[model samples]
Target: MYKILIVEDDNTIAEEVGRYLMKWGYEVEAVTDFGDVLGHFGRFLPQLVLMDIGLPFYNGYYWCGEIRKVSQVPVIFVSSASDNMNIVMAVNMGGDDFITKPFDLEVMAAKVQAILRRTYSFSAPTSLMEYKGMILNLSDMTLVCRDEKIELSKNEYRILQTLFENTGKTVTREAIMKRLWDEECFVDDNTLTVNINRLRKKLEGLGVEELIVTKKGIGYRLGEL
Candidate 1:
């Protein structure tokens, strides 16, 4: 099923849209915390976003731009402000379509299905892993945190991917080494240490400090910053 993220702050409208989408066999989530729109977007990894123009903290345009940074997912603006200026701004900010408020559920669903067919028919959905506010784009091997995009090396990407897959749990060095070995990139203890240190530095640079915690005898685990 295609997933949709609704970024509308109005509870009644959001609920109505969510219910309508769910009834049509589409997975839907309505955003509640407007301050962390991108954070929710990262975590949800929805195939398409339904955004409203007048939001609580940042407007829909800002969130749409942020989504464009890490994803090419289709975004349709749903707002009462259907003026030409707002519509132009929405498209300029990377919106795929705009739906005026008080819209018919059937019309909205049809537009959504059309966009999904056009977007996915030509490309597979990108895989994303998100923890905290950091989003890892598996297709591109890059991480986005606090609006900062960080490119990851092969080893760094593997280490982070392993940790994320087993969040809140310790992963033994032997297990990590085995995973790397399975990928045909054998690394000694020293090399692993270097990679860990480098990854830590990169994470710190993105304001994520002490995320990878080292458990002396066992291995490393993701820690709260």
Candidate 2:
């Protein structure tokens, strides 16, 4: 099930939205501390976020930008601020969609489903891969470190993709070779090594030094920030 983060101050609305979302088979958590919206966000790490405009400490747009700094998870604004200016600002602030408040729960659910499908039901990245401050765009196969964009060569990207996909656990070299070879790329074991070295250099240049580490006998992994 996809996790969802709800950033609304109204306790009634939070319970109401959380209830329906749970009924629809989504794991949801509503924000409790407006001052620490980003903190709760990192802990929840929801696939979709429902944010309200007028909030306690920092507004929804502030929290949205904070989340965007590390992730590209789909965020939809749900607020009473239905004015065109607010909607435009929402989009500019990295909100994927805007749902004006006093909305039909059914319609809200429909839009949520559509956005989830567009982001995950297809051959997308499944979702963006995030490490410390970098977001790896699996859709376009690009690594984003801060404001810098680093493009990867075919082999380099594939190698990094494999390691990050299996971030915590180590991916064996044999498996890496098989995957690369399966892509119609020839590899004689040492080929993977060459690609990894090059990818590491690129990552180090982007401040993600030693982003991919070898396990001597096992393979490689993207362990830390």
Candidate 3:
């Protein structure tokens, strides 16, 4: 299912839109904290965003620009200001479409579906795992955080993928070795340690410190951020 983030200040409108989208099989999150819109956006990693132009705090245009710096996810402006200037500004600021207020929920759903189909149909679905604002794009083997992208080595990517798949749980060294062997890596205990250290350094370079926690006597697991 496609995930959507709704950035509207009006509680009633946000709830109505959220409910309508949910009924149509879309996973939706309505923004409640205006101060940290980008934080929520990064955490949710939604495929599309529904933003109201007039928002509390920094307004939708500012948040949309911030999102564009990290992702090319489709953003549709849903607002009461439907004037040509506002529409133009929305598009100029990276909005994909504009929806006037008082829109029909059915029409809105159809437009959302159409946009989603057009935006994602041509591209392979990207699988993502996120923790503490860090997002791992499994399809691209890239990590994104705070507008920074980090390329991962084969072993590093595999190790992180394993830990993310088993979030908040311990993964044994034996199991990791088995997976690496299956991938034809053929790493020994020492080699695994080297890889883990390298991965930790790379994560630290991206401002994530001590992400991989060693579970002495057991194995390794990701530390909760």
For residues 134-165, what per-residue lDDT tens digits would candidate 3 score against the true structure? 77777778887766788999889899999988
Global lDDT for candidate 3? 0.87
lDDT for 81 in candidate 3 is 90
lDDT of each prediction vs. the true structure? 0.91, 0.81, 0.87
Residues 87-132 of candidate 2 have per-residue lDDT tens digits of 9999999999999879999999999999989988764423566665
Return the top candidate by TM-score: 1
Give the TM-scores of the predictions, in the order they appear: 0.95, 0.67, 0.82
Off by over 4 Å in 3: 35-45, 65-72, 83-86, 120-124, 181-185
Say which prediction, candidate 2 or candidate 3, comes out ahead on TM-score. 3
| Clash numbers, per candidate | 0, 0, 0
Error of 1 at 8 (Å): 0.4
- For candidate 2, the TM-score is 0.67
Question: Which candidate leads the pack in lDDT?
Answer: 1
In model 1, which regions exceed 4 Å deviation? 182-186
Task: Order the numbered candidates by TM-score, best leading.
Answer: 1, 3, 2
1-225 per-residue lDDT for model 1 (tens digits): 999999998899999989999999999998899999999988888999999989998888888888888899999999999999999999999999999988999999999999999999978998888899888888889999998899999889989899999999999998888776676666678888988999999988988898999999999999987
Scored against the true structure, residue 115 in model 3 reaches a CA lDDT of 89
